[model samples]
Target chain A: MSCLETIQSYSLRSIGIGERLLPRSDFTLCEQVVLIGSGMIWNVYFGLMALTTGFFLATAIALGKGSANPWLRKPAEWFIFLFRGSPLFIQFFFAYFLFLNLKGAYPFFDPFTAAWLGALIVLFLNTGAYSAQIFYGALQSIPKGEVEAADAYGLSGWSRFRRIVWPTMLRLAWPAYTNEAIFLFHATTLVYFSGFPAWQQRGDALYYASYFADKTFNPFVPYPILAGYFILLTLVIIGLFGLVNRRLNRHLPANARSKMKLRLNLIR
Target chain B: MFSYCSDPDTLERLWWLSCYLTTGVHFSFYLSFLKVIGILAVTAPVALAFGFAGAMSARSQILPVSWLGKAYIAIVRGVPDIAFFLFFVIALDQGFEWLRHQALCPDWTDPIRQGNDFLVCPQAKLPLGTAPQAVHQAYAFALAVMTFALVFGAFVANVIFGAMRAVPKAQLETAEAYGMSPRQTFWRILVPQMWVYALPGLSNLWQVLIKATPLLFLLGIEDVVYWARELGGTKTARFTAYPHGDWRMWYFLALLVFYLFMTWGSEKVLSRIMARLTRGQATTGGEAQRKGAPA
Candidate 1:
């Protein structure tokens, strides 16, 4: 097949759009690229869904962790510890089996056995725990002067948090959180490889890449393509987070403003 | 195994449980945990050495060497490390075999890349085609360790590079003033002081390294995850002792608790080490110590 024809056929192959059968032999460069690029749709979906939903839970968790009441604090602390302390690979396995058991009991959980929902849930909780810790540190280090200044303006409770505490926490946490976001996206590649089976070969980018590698007995080509796709994805994440970082730090002087630096804050 | 374990069907309930847990496969499962620890023990220092060399090269005055180091660090940061793990094991195996083929069969002219095959000479095969199972396992384990070292080394390099920069410039200048050569300043002054700055990142990397141990299964090693799935799968009465239905979840739960304790214990130990390292340093940790503030 021509390169264009190959693209048309396998472009959405990951989501079961065009192709039913994968290429068996004589794997062309174009076919490998198209199929692997097609699989990126799942990666994007997992990362976007988990990161968006995880953001809200992370905020709650951060606040809960900082709350003075033990009723609130203890559970939040343990939640972070449970998710953060264990390897995410094991979490995927455990969660899959848990969901499978739940499916046995309730018909409503039937869909959770598939990679889409089950793996997404694991990613969501994992990122939530990690980012919550980052946010908690930011919340703690929120300059006391900012809270005092807000108190002077009669800002109290929710408004006080909305006005003074939240923005500063985000501002302080944005850099580390960006790192978390990138890693979460990276972590999404683990979904298909984990316990949750990818229904009908509709797996993620790494999945397709590995498929090509296995078929051709060549690692150099397909793995690099996968890496190239991820590097692009990482850049996109940095660009998006950089925009938010700017908005959060907009009021500060140009020189005094915190710049987003992409560093490895190595959490699994 | 207990003497009563001979006939599992005739055993009491508690005895059945005890015998079940003590099966030979279970012992292998237990040994897999040690295998993980062994990998960590071996990989840590080797990766640190790789990282130190990488950091030094990145900070080198020579342009090409610095770029090479920077590229190594940057690539790992962007790519999912599982990709590297998957890629390197196969790639390295083929790479070694290819080199061996080239040396051992110089007169051979057929292309190695023939459609779906990597046709290296038989003599050049990793562990050789005739090698024993033990040799093959050891070869695979060595490759896994090398892959882990290469990937984690880049991460450590990034940490060490930043830590080197974070060490106060004035201290280096003072070393220079004391008639110390540039190499002396780097070895005697910079390397010694950089550890305190590097400690936080290194500790974080250690936790990451721990979490990453499960990926050893992906490398085809019969690690804990492998044994868990094997032992926990459904077994009918036709099979040997234990007849259980899908106990994989519990096995994974046990593994999860194992990792949780491992990481938590590491946290406690790392914090103590951090305290010891920061005792008299000039950083905020040291300042807090001077003020008798609790960490």
Candidate 2:
């Protein structure tokens, strides 16, 4: 079949659109790229949604962790420790199985069985904990002078936080936050691999790549293609985050500005 | 395992609960925890060796050797590591088999990649088609270890590379001034001093490597996660002597507690090591320790 036909047929193969059965034979590069790219939609969706929501939740967690109140600090510390201490792989399994038992008890919560709800929830909480730790570290590192400056200007309570502390915390945390975002994108690939089943073969990039590998018995082709796509995606993420890092540090002198190099040392 | 455990249906109260908790599946659940540790014990040293080679290569004066090392570290870092894990196992297995195919069967050649199947001579089959099941499991475990090492090696190399750079240049210069060769200085001064700087990153890497052990399940290894799922899923009474309802939550909770304990224990050990390693060094930790000593 022609490349156009292959694209038309397998474009939405991941979400169960266009073609019912995946290309069983004569798998073309066009089919592999299109199907994998289509699958990447889910990766992007999971990463974007989780990172965006996790960002706000992480800020609250950071604040809670740094708060003097034991009620806030203790729970926040436990939450961070619980999620950060374990593997995301285990977290996915634990969450899925826990959700499964919950669904058994209450039939109304069936959505947790699917990746959309189940994996997303796990990713959200996991990233929240990780980013919270980063944010907490950053919040602690926020210069005392900034807060004192706010206080001297008659800024107190909400205004002081809004004007001084929050910005400084973000500026301090931006580099680490970028690393978290990159890993969150990578962690999305683990969703389908976990206990959560990919309904109708609607899965992520690695899932589709694995499908192709299983079919063709040729790991050389599909995996590199997937890797290439991910590398490109990562570059795009780095670029976007670099832009934001620049804005966050726009006021600083060039020598004082923190360079946002990709540090692969941190694990999710 | 009480004597009354033979008739679980008749038993009541805590006695029945106690027996149920110590079932055969629970034993497997407990064993799985050891498997996680086993992966760490094997993977850490291998990955460290690989990282050492990678760092040395990256620092090589030869352009291509350095470039190759840089590329290895960069590619792994750029992509999602899970992607590499999913890819490398199959790719490495196939590469091995393909080499074997060429070596074992010289006369027979009908295109290895014919259509969708990857057919090879029976003589070249990894673990052989008729090998014992244990051999197959061992082969799979080996691949999983390699995958973990290859992926984490890149990160470790990054850490080691930075640590090597962090070693003061003046120390190396002084060694060179004493007529010591570059290699001698690297071993005597650079390598020794680099550890103090590398300890922090290595400790963090150790924690990550510990946490990443669960990914073994995804690689098709019968690790802890696999056993937990297998043993904890809804089991009918017909299947075995001790059957229970869906108890995966409890199984996973056990896993969580196991991991928490492992991490906490690791932190304690790592801190002690760090303290020991920092002694007498020209670093902050060393200075603090010296000051705190009796005057």
Candidate 3:
């Protein structure tokens, strides 16, 4: 098939849209690129949806963790510790099995056995716990001077937080938050491999890559294609976050500002 | 295990439970835990070695060597490691066999890629077709270990590289002023001092590495997850000595608790080591320790 024809047939192959059957024999470069790129839709979906939802929940959890009230702080602390301490792999398994039992008890909950809801839930909670810890650390590290300035301006309650504390918290946390986001994207690949079944052969990038690899017995072509796509995706993320970081630091003098670069040192 | 387990049918709840726990499958389950530990023990040092080399190479004065190291670290960071694990195992296996094929059967040229089959000469089969089952298992395990090391080593290199950079440039300059050679400066001032800076990242990496051991199951090594699924699946009374309902939930719960305990214990030990390392250093923890001591 021509590259255009190949693209038309395999572009949405991951969600079972274009092609009924994956290319089985005579694997071509066009097929590898198109199919793997198609599978990336799920990766982007999982990462974006989970990150969007997890962001708000993480903020709340971070606030709770930093709260003076033990009722709030203790549970938040344990939640962060539990999720952050364990591997995402185990969390996926444990969540899957727990959901399995739950489904057995309540037949209505069987939807949790599949990737969409079940894996998303695990990714959501797991990323929330991780990001919450990052935000908590950022919240603590917010400059005393900033809060003091707010107090001097007669700011209190929500006004004080909105005008002063919140911005600084986000600014301080932005770098770490960026790291958390990258790691979450990487972690999304683990969803299918865990206990959650991929319904209708609908799987993510890695899933489809494995499928192609298994089918063709050629790992060299497909895996690197996925890797290249991920690198590009990661660069896009870095670029987007870099813009936000710049905006956050915009008011500061140029000499005082630090550029946000991809520091692979931090792993979730 | 118990002497009171005389009559099999009359053996009620406790005795039956004891026998069931001591069954061959349970032994395999326990051995799987050791496998997890064994992977960690083997992978940790090997990964560290790879990381050290990677870090050193990245810091190399030569542009190409540094670029190669930097690429290794960056490439793994973006992509999900599970993808690499899934991809590399088969790729490495094929790569090995293909190399063997080229070497052992140079003249015999039926295309290696015939339709979908990766056909190799009989002699080029890794472990050979006639090799024992244990050999195949060992080969798979070795592949899993190498994949783990390759992926995790990149992360470690990133950490170690940052830590190496974090070691104050002044320390190296001081060593230089004291008449130390370039190699001596690196050995005496840089490498030794970098660990203290590196410990936090390395400790975090260590925990991540521990958590990542379960991916061995995905790599087709029969680790704990495999055992859990195997032992926890539903079984009819006719199929086994001790038949049970689907108990995967309980099995996974056990795994969860085991992991939680392992991580909790490691955190405790790491904190103690952190405390020890922080003593007499220039950081906040060191300052705190110095202040807390009696004058």
Off by over 4 Å in 2: A265-267, B1-3
lDDT ranking from best to worst?
1, 2, 3
From the highest TM-score down, the ranking of the candidates is 1, 2, 3
Q: Report the C-alpha lDDT of model 1 over B1-295, residue by residue, as the tens digit.
A: 9898988988888999999999999999999999999999999999999999999999999999999999989878778889999999999999999999999999888999998998987888889889999999999999999999999999999999999999999999999999999999999999989999999999989999999999999999999999999998889989767887888999999999999999999999999999999988999889989899654
- Residue A5 displacement (Å), model 3: 3.0
- Name the best candidate (by lDDT): 1
Please provide TM-scores, in order, for all candidate models, with all chains considered together: 0.98, 0.96, 0.94
Q: Backbone clashes in each candidate structure, one number apiece?
A: 0, 0, 0
Query: Over the stretch A1-268, how does candidate 3's per-residue lDDT look in tens digits?
Result: 8999999998988788887877777778898888878878988999999999999999999999999999999999999888887778878888888888888899988888778888899899988999999889989998898899889989999999888888888888898889888888888888888888877777888887888788888887788888898888888888888899999999999987865756653334
Q: Which residue pairs show collisions in model 1?
A: none
Candidate 1 lDDT for residue A37 = 95
Off by over 4 Å in 3: A265-268, B1-11
lDDT of 2: 0.88
Candidate 1's TM-score reads 0.98
Name the TM-score of chain A in model 2.
0.97
